[model samples]
Target: MASIRAEDLRIEFPLYHFARSMKKRLLGVASRRVKEDPQNRVVISALSDLNFTIESGERVALVGHNGAGKTTLLRTLAGIYEPVGGRLTVDGEIGCLIDPAAGMDGLSTGRDNIRLRGLYRGLDAAQIAALEADAGEFSGLGEFLDVPIHGYSAGMSIRLAFAVATAFQPQILLMDEWFSAGDADFMAKAQTRLEQLVKASEILVIATHDMDVVKRWCNRVIRLEAGRIVGDEVV
Candidate 1:
């Protein structure tokens, strides 16, 4: 079953220096000794007591302005960041592409990164080999897969990322923005395959500021502002 539940989730960044500075403010010790690291900066409140639940086969779009905590929430849900408070539960195979290049090693060749991502996503060697062959059709970086990924142009990296991400259908697929890349001609070809992923995936949660995408792709939508949910409704 594809399900997600988050209960009173609270995420916070620690303020070691901010706390210490409070004491300095009281004690009147004016010294620059605390400039050792940036961790002394004020702690940030990323997510504040958020609560939500989604049953099997539901689609939701996260809509928010830049830095309104959409990515932080998604990253928390993807288990990349541990919530400081609250409980979250997910039942499904989650495929996340929040950061297209998160797992890639720039020094590695595209071919190696493909295999690495496949393996990290839990596919065995035999299954990865089959998927690798199809990756070529979509990646379009012909002959460059063996070249270091650091040298790939932005378009080429996006192409390779899309290919690797859509190599398999997922139960719960998460995306930040549907990347727009490739030449106009290549994009047309890639669009068909990208759409194929949307059709085959069982559940999806996409984060975007694009209102048009939220309308077209999500049956339900939630809008966030300043780390709080300002609106939510079914489209």
Candidate 2:
């Protein structure tokens, strides 16, 4: 079964621009002892002492004000950021929709990107062919898929990206607000696809400011403030 567990999980980022004196002053103003990594570089804690377990069939929403670590938490779960001072275990095939075009090569054709996505996921030739066919049909980009992605418009790019990212079913799905491009028909199709994906996944974690969406799709909410979880509730 796919699951996620965090034990006193802590994530931090280095403050490379801060002088020692400035760091000291900031630490004093914050009234907290400064933490340094093994290399002794000053760091700002992004998540602190987090403990949680997400089992199969959980639909969880990460919510908080801006800079409250919602996005940071999502990134951490996706393995984009390593915890600096704790343990995190995730067992699943993860599909990240954090940024639809995040890892795409803009200079490459959309077709090339489909093949690359297949390769990254370690799909066999038959599966890659299927993904290409699926993306081509779902994205509605037709001949544009053969052209370099940089030449596509914003809506076209998002459609292609979303199509390719979701070509395979993942055990765990992670997403940000993420649905802002395309026309009305595309929006409707995207919404349907999102619902289908969520239904098919073992676990779903999303970070969003949209309370309506949370209420509609999530069963639990984990709220954060200043990198600490303040509220964890079953909706």
Which of the numbered candidates is closest to the native, going by highest TM-score?
A: 2
Please list the Cα RMSD from the true structure of every candidate, rounded to 1 decimal place. 5.3, 2.0
In angstroms, how far off is 40's CA in candidate 2?
4.1
Q: Measured by TM-score, how close is model 1 to the native structure?
A: 0.85
> On a 0 to 1 TM-score scale, where does candidate 2 land against the true structure?
0.92
Model 1 whole-model lDDT (C-alpha atoms): 0.79
Runs in model 1 with CA error above 4 Å?
15-42
Residue range with the least summed lDDT across 10 consecutive positions in model 1: 31-40
lDDT of 1 by residue, 1-235 (tens): 7898999987775556446657446335443222222444544677777888877766789998887788888888788889878899988888887877779999999999998988887888898898788886678888999999999998889888888887878788888885776678778877787667776777788888888777767888988776777888888
Most accurate candidate by lDDT: 2
Give RMSD (Å) of candidate 2 vs. truth.
2.0
* Candidate 1 residue-wise lDDT at 140: 83
Give the TM-score of each candidate: 0.85, 0.92
